[model samples]
Every structure is written in C-alpha cells, then in structure tokens.
Target chain A: MKRILATLLACVLLLSCMSFAAAEDKKTLTVWIPQYQFSKAEDAISDQDFWDGVFDPFEVENNCEVKVEIVGWGIYGDTFFTSLVNEDGPDLVYVTDNYDLVKRDLLLGLDPYLTQEQKDNVILWNTAPENANGEKVIVPMDDGVAIGYVNKALLKEAGLDELPVEWDAFIEACKTIQEKTGKRAFLQNWGATSGTSALMLAFWPYYFQAGGKMLNDQGEIDINNEAGLKTVEFLKSLLDAGIFTEDIVTESESVDKFAAGEVAYIVADLNKGNSAFTPAGIDWEYVFSLKGPAGYGARTATDSFAVNKKTVARGNDELAVKALMYITSGAVMDEFHSKIFYLPPFTKDASFVKDEALYALTSAHSEDVYVVEEFSAKKSFEDTLLANIQEMFQGNLEPQEVLTETMDYYNTQLKEN
Target chain B: MQKTFFSRRRRQALIGGAYILPSFVLMFIFNVSPIFLSIFYSFTKYDMTAAPVWVGLDNYIKLSQNKYLGNVLTNTVQYVLITVPIQTILSLLIAAFIAGSLKNRYGSFLRSVIFIPVIASLIASAAVWDTMYKPDGGLINQFINLFGAPSVNFLGKKPTALPSVAAVSIWKSTGYYMVIYYAGIMNVSTEVQEAAIVDGASPIQRFWYITLPILKPITYMIVTLGIIGSFQVFDLVYKMTGGGPGRATLTVAYMIYSYAFQDKRMGYACALAVGLLVVILLIHLIQTLFFKERDAK
Candidate 1:
C-alpha cells in the first residue's frame, strides 16, 4: 500500500510539472472588445465561435494563444478602469474616444509598428498620428455618420415626394405629416442608456449645423454662445409644436414606432439604422443630415483598435500590435462590414457595403460629418448636457440656461480631468 | 501552581489566536487595507494609471464647489427617509400580526411568499418595475387607462422618478426586513405575553406594553441596517433611472460610481466615498445614542 501511494504521488507531481511546462511554452494575449452591433456575424452561433474563426489562424501563425472577451457597453467603463488600475488589463481593446486613455498614458503608441502602406491607405479620423500628440495610438476600424431614417411608406402616405434635405423643409414636412396622417413625426431617442445617443442624434448635429465649435483655441468648451442657444431653441420649438414630448425623454420606443409606421422620421446611426429597420422589413431611406443655417453638418462616429501599454509590460507588444493590425486589415473588416451592417471601412479599396445608396450619401456628406473633439470631459459633458436638454424639453429651463449650465459643468469637470 | 495555571492559560490563548489568525489576515488584506488606502487616496490626485500626486484638500475643495452635490445629498436623504421608516414599520407590523394571531401553517406559507422578493435579483426586479412603469402601454398605465385617465410618464417626470425608484427599493427590501423581524418576534417569551394577558390586558395593550419593549433591541438593529442600506443605494437607481430626467434621482453612491469608473476621477470619488463613510458613522452613533437614551428612560 505504501509503495502504491508513493507511485501515485510521484505520477501526480510529474503531470503537474508537465502541464506547467506546456503552459509556459506559448504566451497568451488577452483582448477585450466592447459589444458593438456588428462585432459578431449574424449567422454565427455565438461570440466565441465568431472570434475563434477570426483569431485561430493568427494564433497558429504567431505560435501563441489569443484570449478574447466581449464586454457589454453598460459595464465596459467600469471593467476597463478597474482592470487597468490593478495592472491586469488586456493587451488590446476597441476604443471610440481614446482621449481619456491617452491622457493617462494607458495606451501603447502604434506609430512605430505601422507599415507605411497601412498608414497611407487607412483613413484616420481624430486619432491620426499627427493629431495624437505625435503618438499614433489607434488604428481606425469603422466610420459612421449621424443621419436620419425616413420610412418611405410613411413619406408616401404623407404625400411627400422626397425626404426634406433642409431643416425648415423637414420641419414643414413633419408638421404636414402630423396634421394629415395623425401620426407622430421626427422622433429622436434620448433614453438610450449608453453612448450619449441624444446628444449625437438631437443636439451636436444641429449645433454643428448651426455653426458651433465645441472647443475654442484655449481648449475650453465654447458651446454656451449663440449657436448653442439656437440649437436649444430649435429643439424647444419642436417641443412646443408637439413634435417632441415628455415621453421622448423616457426609454427609447422610437425605433419600434417608426418601424410600425406610427412615426415618419427618426435619427439613427448606420449600424442601428440598418439592423433595426431592415429586419423589420420597413421601406426606409437614409436622409443625409438636414441642412441648417450653417449649410449642413452631422456627427460622425469613428472607433479604432487600441493596444494597451500593458502589452509592453508583458513583453508582447509586437505580438499585440500584429494582432490588432490583422484584425483591422481590409479583408477582415470588409467581411465584418458585409456580414453585419455597412459602415465605411478604414481602407480606401475595401468596399463590401450592401447598401450602395447609404454608402454614396454618407460619402458625399463625409466631409461635413464631424466627430466632437477628443477630451477627458466628453462623457461627463455629454451626460449632463443630455439631462439639461431633457429639462428644457420639460419646460423647466430656458434655452440659455441649458447652454450655460451644461458649459459650466463641462468646464469644471474639464479642469479636474 | 500559579505558574502552571498561567502557562495553561497562555497555551489556550495561543490556540485561540492560531484559530483566528487566517481570518484576521484575510480581513486585514481585503477590508482593512482598502479602507486605509481609500483615505490616503482621498488626499492625492490619483487616476490609478500614474503615480499619485499629493494634492491636499483640492478634491475636498472641489466637492464644496460642486453644484450637483447638494441635489444628490438631498435625494439620498429623501430616499433614506422614504425607504427606512416605511419598510421598518410595515415589516414590524406584519411580523407581529403573524406571531400573535396567525401562528399556523398558513402563516408559515405567507411568510415564505412574502420572502420571495428578497431572493429575487435586484436587477431583474428593477427591470420589471421599469417596464411596468412605462408610459406607453405599460401594465400600470394600461390599468389606469381603464378608468379613462390619460397615461402618466411615471419615471420621465422629475417629481415621480425618485419616488418610483424608491417604491421599487421598498418592495425589494421589506421582505428581508420582515424575515429578520419575524425571527426576532419568534424569540420573544410566551410567558411574558401570558402574564400580560392574565392582567386583563387587551391584544393591543399586550403588544404595546410587552412585545414592543422586548423587540426594542431588534428594532434598533433593523433601523440602523436599513439606514445604512438605504443611504448606499445604487443598483435600483442605476437600473431604473440612470440618474436621469435631469438629475432627479441622482444619489451620492451613483455619483461616486460615475466619477470613479465613467469619469476616472479616482481621487474625487475617494473623497466622496470617505465623506459617505463619515456620514454613515455619525448616523450610526446617533442611532446608538438614541437607543441608549430610550433604554435608560
């Protein structure tokens, strides 16, 4: 019995040592991707399956292990902050606005790793090498415009030949539709829990359309001036005209109503527009941002792949950058865009968008669509601004008060940041 | 003999210490260390990514100038006032009635039923309540419409949002407190109740005079726990309102979460957290003094 026990213990120790040796043979690269609408293919069985299909070949080629986690939007901030604070963050992540991360030096610069062709071919947005304090910290992944969706059936019922391209004409069309069809017109979602949906759809596009600059030369928020007040007053006019109501500030039921043809127009981004309207089988057309007093403007969304500096700490910086580049390559992104919804890919030649009309309209207005300045105070400013606008819609605050209060909060928070 | 006795006592003490050493070490690492670190971090500007810069009193000064601080504090106090008293009284009454009149199988089944919400997930409960409070075709709105009344956006209006969230918290918590009170009441002496009955005391009188006094310690404990719990409310408000409709339901805890996580203002959030700790400590001290005074009287 003693001999048998000794033999068994020896065998167990040997197996444990072998397992540890095997683990040490290959390095593990951790990646966290926030849950986007098109992060996975529609027909894929699960996120794990989709990511496995994308990463298996790369892992084999690199002779390393790739571990991926799909994080939800709601807890993404908390998860990333806590993990990075403990020095246990993933090697790479998808970041839309990297200002906060860059300010803290949490991201690894990708400029040293990028090939000249990658740099020249990819259309970088705000995080270009020249713009990011001379450190290229992100590789552009997808681009989208803040545009409105018009239900063609509803427009036909309302006796409009085409969706209005100008703000005044759009307002007139909405009012005429409300009067004739007795259906609500022009709904913007204010209650989206994440991503400052209201500010993107209802506020910033209009503010820019009215010729407002988000920041001044001194890097101060400059939205409390005439253009800001005008945007607020325009929204207030909508409230007074019964185009918006207290219900609009509640959780979003706008897309559902629009698909049901109870509403004629609703503002949405590319992914949300296609995924929502196409599946509902609604005859909807994209309306490039309505031209306003300053000509025309829309909010553009650009997200990128960011490598964490923790990759360098782990001695896998090159491996992580290689993986990021592979993921953002033209072929991979084209497949990704075609499988889900259409967003303009980073590479000029990568065009797999199924919706050509949307592609053309978005491209035509691409120069007019602008993303807000990258700053640490963006989230706080957007949240408070949304709340203040909601108050204005409730008739609790005047337009000037909304602008003043929002800017006050933003400037104060910006100082802390 | 004296030396032997002392040695035996020392041995016993050593054994006890050995038994408690593991838990003490764990507590020190996880709980005690974090408390001290939080206090230290409150005095510095630390974003967790870089070395903390000593910025004495800056975070605190910013707190004083924060325009939203007063509103969040008022909301938190209002939430505590609304939830704690109502839940305490309701749980106490229900527990007492069950013990006195319906101490049968039906009572046991009813207790189990009432305890259901205590076991349900807060997120799930809040989500259900949010849907039910929706303005368009929600359960409550649909029922109200039966009487030919217009739909009311219960959570969209500032006046109704906080109270609506409070209602959900009360619903979720009353059961847990009810169970505690039920156990406390079960431990009450039957002989005392019989003695009061022999003196020709009525049900109400016996309850007021005997059972209530016996449950005083339990009541104090329940109220203290309730106050702390209510003051630190986050999940219900987070799921229900997200501090929306123009900051109507913003609480201090949610604000701290937003700052620490969303805004990455760790030092400011730590200052806020330390302030919350002091407030809770003062509240507990006051509650203890009140209970002691009542006992002395």
Candidate 2:
C-alpha cells in the first residue's frame, strides 16, 4: 500500500511540470487591421480573411495565437490616436503614413527587432520617414501609390493617338480635348476637403518632377526656389487657360467624373483607376511617369504597419515580430498582391504577372515612389499652402499671390511655434 | 428633543445626497469637467499626443487673423437666421392643424410621416438628398428639365450649395419641432381656448390670440434649439458639399473640426469653440433681457 501511494504522487508531479512548460511555450498576438469594401462587391473582403487564409498557418505551425480585429478607416484617426496615446494599444497596428507614433516615441523601432533573413524577404519602402530620427518605426505593408489614368475615348476624341509622355504635350492634349470636344480638358483635384488628396494627387508629382523640395536642411520654407516657381507657373498657366476645373470639392467627384468620361486626363491610383472605372465599362489607360522640366518620375503615398512597445512590455513582442515577418515575407506577399491589384515593389523572388493581359494594369512605369513625409509642424504649412492653391483655382487669388501668401503664412506659423 | 430633531434632519440630508449621487457623478464626469477642460485647453497648444505647451491668447490672435473667419461667421449666422424663424412658424402651424383641425387617425398618420425624417439617420438622409440634387439623372433636375431649364448641380455650384443644404436642414427639423409644439398645445388650458371660441372668436383668431400666447415658451425652445443646431451644422455640409465650391458652405463648426482634427491645431479649435460659446451666451442673454422687458411692460 505504501509503494502504491509513492507511485501516484510521482505521476501527479510529472503532470504538473508539463502543464507549466506548455503555458510558457504558447503566446497570443493581437493586430488592429483596417478593412475596405470594393464597389459592387457583396461581402467585404475583410482583413480577417488575411489571418484566416494567410496567417492562420503561421499561427498553427508556430503553436501560437493571432487575433485580428477588423476596424474601418472611417473612425480610424480618433480610434488609433486614442489607443496609441493611452498606450493600451494592440501588438501590431496598421497605419498609413503614421509619423506621430514615431515623433511621440510611442512605437518601438523595428530596425533592432528585424532579422537579416526578415530584412531580405520584404521591400522596405518609405525609407525616409521624416522625423523618425532615422529609425523605421513603421514598415510599409501595402501600396497607396497613385498613377495617372487616361480615358481612351476622351483621348481619341481629342485626336491624340497615344497618351502624352511630356508635360508640354500633356497640356497640349488637354487644350485639344477642350477645344475639340468641349469637355473639360484636364482634372487636377483642387479645393479637396481632404488636404492629403490636394497634395498627393495634384501637387506632389508636379513639385517632385520639377525638382522642387519641401524644405531645406535648416527646415525653412523653400518656396522661392526655381523648381517651385517653375511648377507653380505651369499650374497657373493651366488654370488660366481653364484647363482645370474648380467644380470638384471632394475626391469622390473626381472618380465619378472620370467614370462618366467627362475629363480627358486624370490622376488616380489603381483602385480608383481600375476597380471603379474599369467595372463601370470606361475605356482606360494607366501611366506611371510624366516627364517635366526637371526629370521623369512619380511619387505616391504608401500604407504601412508598426509595432507597439506596450506589446513588447507584455512579452508578446517576439510573436508580433514573427507575425510581421511572416506576413510580409516574399512567400506570402506574392499571394497577397495577386488577390488585389496593389502590387508591391519589384522583388525577383515573387511572380506578380499572373496573366500577361492584366500585367499593364498592375505595373508602374517608374519604381521611384515617394511617400509623404510627416513632421511635427507640417500640418499648418499644408493648410496654408492648400488654402492658397484652392483660392487660386477659384479665381480669388493668382499664383504669385499664392506663392507670397504661403511663404508669409509659413513664416508666421513657424514663428508662433 | 432638540438633539433628536437635528439628528433626524442630518439623516434626511444624507439620504437626499445618496439619492442624487449617481446623477451628480455623471454630470461631473461628462458635462462639467469637459467645459472646464475646454476653457483651459484654449490657452494652451495641446496637440493630441504631446504634452501641452502654454501659449496664452496666441490662438485667439491667430483666429482673429484668419481671412476665412468673416465668411464662416457670416455663413453660420445666415444659416441660423434662415432656418430658425421659418422652422418655428411652420412647425407651430403644422402642430396647430394636427391638434385642432385634423381628424383623429389622419393626424397621427401625418405626424408619423413627417417625423420619419426626424428619426432617419442624418447621413442616410443626406445621401438620399444628394442623389435628388445631383446634376444628371436626379429627380429635381429631371423635374426642372420638363420646363426646358438647364441642369443645375445644386450641391456642386457655389451659389446653390448653401441654400440646397439649408433646405434639407429645414425639411429634417420641422417635424421634430412640430412634435414639441404638439405637446405644448396639448398641455395648454382647454378652458381658456373654449371661452375664446364661445366669445365669437374665429378659428384663425382663436389660434392667433389664444394658442399663440400660451406657446411662447415652446416657441422660445424651438427657436433657440433651431438657432443652435443651425449654428453648429456639420454633418450635412460634410456629407453633401464638404464645405466646398470655395468655402460656400463652410460653417464655424466645420472649421473647428478642420482645425482640431485635420490640421492638428487643438488650441485654435478650442479657441474657436470658446468664441462660439460666448456668442451663443450673448445671444441668449439678449433674448432673455428683451423678453423680460416685454413681459414686464
């Protein structure tokens, strides 16, 4: 009877030890993901599907758990800002151009956490995130790139055989479309309620392709530079000729006008140019680069992801890091891009050309992409600059007035800060 | 005996305090504290993430310097002036008809139909109105085209955008004020109304002399709330025109939102908010003083 009691005690101790070991091995990672609903699509192709189809295997194989909370972009600003400041955020956060997290020191820099193998697997776009102090706090997850779209019918009506590649010919085509067809020649989205739209689609490409810089090394307004003057002069000429319309007050109208074939040339991203316009049966062509005075190039915004230090403090940092690496690795990224038209940067390991016919729809002419860099005091500058531009379009102010007033406003805001 | 009376009084006071504790706590947390915080934040440059920096009166100075302030103030006041009195008079007339003239079941059904817009989501209502006011393939345009009128982009053009948005506001709010007036008319002394009727008062005279005076308080409420709502109009403008066509529909409230969230200038937003509050209070004070003098006379 004594021997039997000893054997029972030993079995209980062994079982208890195994339970502790199992608890130490497994972990749970939480991610906040944004969702989009494509037009005419019944069920939303949500981010949860990403976890289920892509990350579920990663979770199972690693013997860990991943929780994906599908949030919408409608309330994303308030919700994300609240969670981040409170430091009660998720393990991984999905954000597009989130410089505040870096400026406020709320996020953990990913440079130290990434492995050599992990670094090689993903395209590290958005390398020069301003005010990050050279630390990559957020790694880009998807392309928010914008390229110009050509309406074939509108172009044909204007008697143009091919899409214009130079700035001069582009304006000429705009003039022809207006003179011949009596339709609006070109649509540059101005007076946009969304400040980002005004800058990204209308002004950024023009500024960049003209060799204009946002700021000098000393962080002063570089408004009087030759590049800026050249670009502003060009835009003013277009406005003076009535090539650009002041009818658009919102971004959605730009898309609607394009879909209705009301404009000859428009600048839009793939989702806007293809998903909305193509499905509506509008004959369209996509262009990446337009040669201007300085050079040939294009720059568009990028959507990205970042890790929270609160998750690191919770000791689930390793799991979150693994999740980011696994999802962005060349193996999964190709599959991810194949489903959506949001193609990643060129990687030799992945095959994005699923169909030869659809290849033109997914590729950009230039790999040179520019993400909007956000700094602490850039908001006031953006507001002042965009307001002047809008006024100029509405015939309230001229390009020279816009230029002078913008510099004055920039200086005033700088002095106050 | 005196000591026992005092003890009983203390116990009564304690019980009363216990009864009102929940509401007091809620008001303190939600309403009272926010007002104080808003006032404090107006003087500080408080970006949402960083620690606030003290910058006294700088925000207010900038607000004064803003070139668009005049337009925003004009738009807000114009909206209020257009919407409030029209809504008040219309709702009162409708409520009177429903209360006195309309048959039993029909009045209820009519009230229900009118109140439908009140209960419908504002965003959804804006969307439906947007489609109706659209330039092409719109109901309003389609109707106007019958008389050979050219297509008008009601929400798109600057001249028509503000008025178009205002019309939607009036349509949405008239029924809500009507219900309020309906309740006020019901509570009015029936005996007074009957005496006026027996004293050879016509139906119009009875309503004008008898019901209108009794509805003064309700009218004040409807008008004041209407003024406030119009002054702070954001959702319709946001959904319909987005304060666009060159700031035609930009209101003070929309400007505040732009400053606070989009521009990340929280101090300036709070300053604007405080300015709005002060203006509202002054208007109410004038209204009260004017009404008090009239009553005394």
Candidate 3:
C-alpha cells in the first residue's frame, strides 16, 4: 500500500509540473517596434542602452517576461494595423504620431486599467480620448511641436544682438541676415500639398499674431476675417522677399541646407532641430513665435499616442497601461530626449532643463507653448488650407487667391462633413 | 483492340495534365487569387483595421476628380512615352554594334557588365542612384558643374524629379533590353549578313534594312515589357525620391501606397490600383492589336 501511494504522488507531481510550464508559457507578452533599439555595439551603448535598462528593471519588478519584435519603419504602419485587425496583435507598439491611433482603431484604452490616482498623475495634454465605442486607446509617449531655429552666429553677423521678438522685426532680421551673409534667410519644407502642413506650422504663429484663431470651439473654420488675410499677406511678403528657400515644399532639402549653414533660420519640428542641429554640431537656438501686432504667440502642433479599446477588452489592459505609463513617464522620456536630443513633454524644472540651449528656449517660451488641439472638427478643412498655402509658395496662386480658395474649400468641407 | 486504344489515349491525356498540374496550382494560388482579391477590394473601402465596406464606383469617381491623380497619371504617361522608345532604340543600337564588331568572348563579357544592373537588386541600385542624384554631392551634379552648368536640384524640383527618376529606370533596364536584342541579332542567319556585305551595303544601311526589320518581334516584346514595368514602377521611386519635391515623382502605385498605408484609405487605394491596371490593360490591348496588324501586313 505504501509503494502504491508513492507512485500516485509522483504522478501528481509530474502533472502539476506540466501544467505550471504551460501557464508560464501562456504569460508571454509581445511588443512590436520599428527597429531594434540597438543594432550596433556603439549605438546599443549610447542610444538603446536606456530602453534595455528601463525594461529590464520593469520586467524584474513586474515579474513578467517581455518579448520584442522589430519591424522596419517603412512597413510598420501597414503591418501593425493589419495585425491588429486580425486580433493577433502585440501587447505594445511604438507609433510615430498620434493620428495613427486616432484615425485607426488599432490601440487599447487604458481608463479601466489605471486607478483614478494613476490617471490623474498623467499629463492632461498627453491623454487621448476614446472613439464612439469609448476606448482611451493611446498614451502620448513624447510631446512633438514645430518651432523655429535661428543660427545665433548668423544673427550676430547680421548685427543682431537679440532674436526677433515681433513679426515685423523677424522679417527685417531675415532681410538683414540675407543681405549681410548672402545666405538664404528663412527656409521651410514646402513642395506638394503636404508641404502646406509645414507652412501651417509657421502660419499658426502669424495667425495668432494677427489675432486670428484657426478654429473655434465647435471646430469651424475661423480664418476668414481680416486677421487671416493679414497672415496670408505676411507669408506672401516673405516669399516675395526671397527669404524662404526656393524649394520650400520639398522635405528636408531646405532643412539640410540650413544644417549646412546655407540658411540662417529654418522652421522645423522641434524634434528635427534637436536631431539635426545638436548632433551635427551646429550651434543653433530655438525662437518662440515672434509677437505679432496683436502680441499673441501661437501654439505649435501636438502629436500623441492612444490605446486600442479592443486590446483593453481582452484583459491585457493592465499590462498595456503599465507599458504606456512606463514609456511616457518623466524618467524614461528624459532619457530618450537627452540621448536623442528631443524635447521632452514633461514639465521642466531647473533640473529638467540641463541643456543650456533647451533651457533658455523652454524657460522663455514656457507660457507661450500652445498645444494644437488633437481632435479638430475641421481636420479636412485644415488639410485644404495647407494645400492652398503650398500653392501660394509655388507662385501658382497669389496668397490672397489661395486664402480665398482655401476659405471656399473649408466651407465646402464643413458643409459636407 | 478498341479498349486498348481508348485506354492508351486516356493515359496520354492524364500524363500531360499531370505535367502541368503543379505549375497551374502554384500560379492560381500565388498570382491569380491575389489579382482577383485586389479587384474585389478595389470596389470596397478597406482600412486594414476593419472589415472592408463596398463603395462600388465611388473610388473611381473620386479618382477622376483628384487633381493630384491627374498629375501623377500625366507623369506616368510621359515616363512610358519617353523611356520606352529611347531605351528600346539605345539597346538595339548597342546590341547590333556588339553583335557586328566585338569578339565573341569580349562581347559576352561586355554584355554581362551592362546587364549587371538588371540582376542587381532594385533597392541596392536605387541607393546608388540616390547618391548620384544628390543635388549637393551627387556625381550627376558634379559632372554637370564640370561642364560649367549651374547646380540643379534634380530630385527636389517638380519639373525635373519625374524625368530624373525615369532616367535611373532607363539606365538600370537598358542593358537587360540590350541583351534581349543581342540574342535577336545572334539569331539572324549569317548567310544573309554575308550576302549584304558582298552587295557592298554599308554597316548602317545593312543594319537599317536587314537587322531592324527582322527584329520587329523583339521590339514589340520590349515595348510591352516597358509599358508594364514603367506603370508598376514603385520601389525605385519609393527608395529614391518618395514621390516628393511635392508629389513631383508621385506615381499611381505610390499614391495607392500612401492612401492604403499612410492614410488608411484602403478602398480608395484599391480603386486607384484597379484603375491603373485597367489603363495598362487598355494600352496593352491597343498596342497588341496595332502591332499584330502591322506584322500581318
């Protein structure tokens, strides 16, 4: 009888071991990203090291293993959406822009996963709203805004001690720089209809300067008044002055020229300035939107992340939320920003602004930093306006004509939608 | 005897069917199915994340209204019209020259060298071309500058970007077409060439009268291939200019990619793609009909 009991006990132990192994295997979570953070030893050490350090600690603390799958950036957008639709998606993904989450129902909402206290801790500006189905799909990983970068040396050469503080002064400064340095003064990415998007970044500051709002609370097109026309005229005058690069609509061509010091000032996303200028060892300074006649500084555009509601409903909510919080947390962001020289979205104290150039710009423009509303009613209208602006830059349409055409387009879109 | 004869015929038919089964199955699964699916999707709106919604002819209607589509279509036609004829003529000339003059071994070596790009991966060749087309540091610009020409933003300017991309496509495919023509030249009977030489016909005159007319079939083949290839041109444009300098290099395929992948307008993209396919098919049909008539005459 004792021998029989011993055999039964051994069988029970073997069965339990098999079940435990299966359970462990079932707990595996998959994360997808564009590229492996570290492919080269040096790149691994300098850039990807922080991701490993952050995730490794989190894994140990959470008692879960995380698997990462690297996809090429070129194909990631299509592949990620396709995988999500199939319900064979990853637990976490890195998205380049917030529109990816807002436009597609690919992410999970984190509301149910996080405690009220935890939700409250997140920056309000970074929180993405749910769709009609009520899913808070994405968490903003970084704050990206378009800003102007001025070459300090060029400004000094042009006998300017301080950067331009007003619209008129800005234009004069550009002219002075052009005359003195024989270099293109203002350069922007402009080419096709999409080039209009970059121009809108610069256009926003002028709109604010002219006391014109782009959209009202209801998200109607509001740039139909005198303020809007003034903004258009200002853009035209700049173009006429030959201050902007000839290839204003092209991507990165003008920015590249600026980086090579062929242009004195460039309008680009803050992230681009950080990446191109800082790494290339070009001495540059960020300029806040110059105060126009109305003395208002326009806010730059904001892109964020969202969670997919479908993923949340599948009981992966907690893990996904935790991953979102971890990536967006001040510490992880600070590491990413410092390494890549990107501007962090988190509130900056004296300690946060360690880089002198970054500190000076952020501190000075702290109150002026405006966030573009992520959800706009007239999104399509905004796209049309952008295209018209490109036409203006191309000299195919006069600025006034383009603005009028844009107003008509916006009116039509508003009526249709 | 009747039973034996019937059984033998049936067995022969079965053997022939068995020989083609693998190829037929593979083609159906890989090629035919995808084509049909694409056609079906073209009539629907598929955003990749949700079920496709049927929109019928709406996508085609929208395509007609799209101004950018018109521009890209024009660009594509220009590319086909210019690159096809020049590439065919250049390849034929080089093939004829090599076939007439060069030693057999040297000719083969030279042909191989020229065809190296044909075998080289499109992405790799595009990367090399990207450097060569760079406005500031590209080899093309340097050569132009050496000739006392001003620097031109070949890929950055709208007027030049499409032509520039076309030039690269021509350069890469020229040798492949040349090899095809070379084969055609080789097949020309030696007796005919010897007779032409004995009649004291000049090389150019002999080539024009004898070689050119005889190579009509090869020319037709090249034209068909060029039309299909040029319309499907995506990878090189994607890698090099990304249809940029403000949609200057935008082709139908690239537009479909942007709509499907970037904008998530899969239905619209599919419609655009289907439209392109139809256009290509129509062109091919017209060309075939005309060429067949010409050959018949």
Give the per-prediction TM-score of chain B.
0.96, 0.95, 0.93
What TM-score, over all chains together, does every model reach? 0.94, 0.88, 0.84
lDDT of 2 by residue, B13-74 (tens): 99999999999999999989987888899999987877788899988998888777898899
**What is the C-alpha lDDT profile of model 1 across A179-231, one tens digit per residue?**
87888988877765543656777788999998998878887667898888888
Model 2: how far is A144 from its true place, Å?
5.0
Best by DockQ: 1
Give a tens-digit lDDT track for model 3, residues A1-417. 999999999999999999898667544456665553322335534434456566787777776666666678556655776666676677777654445456565666566677665565555534455655775655543344456788887888888887776777788888989899887788655542332354456677677777876666786556778888888888878877777655555444667777887777776766656557767677788776667778756465434444444555666667666876776677776666655445545522202444466557665766665555443223344545665665566766776776777676445422222
Best of the candidates, TM-score: 1
Candidate 1 residue-wise lDDT at B140: 96
Model 1, position A277, has a per-residue lDDT of 78
Candidate 1 CAPRI category = medium
Candidate 1: which stretches are off by over 4 Å?
A1-23, A37-42, A129-133
TM-score of chain B of 2: 0.95
Clashing pairs in 1: none
DockQ of each: 0.61, 0.33, 0.26
Each prediction's whole-model lDDT (CA): 0.81, 0.74, 0.70
Which is the leading candidate under lDDT?
A: 1
RMSD list, candidates in order: 2.7, 4.9, 5.2
lDDT (Cα, tens digit) per residue for candidate 2, span A1-417? 999999999999998899978867878777887764343566545456755677678878988877888788765755676676775678887775465566567776676777655555455544625334565666665464567778898889878887786788877877888898888767766645555657777777887878877667875556657777777777877866667655444335567788888876777765675577878788987777567887765666656777776777888777787787676666776766656344554333566554343355334344455556555445455655676676666677777777787777566543335
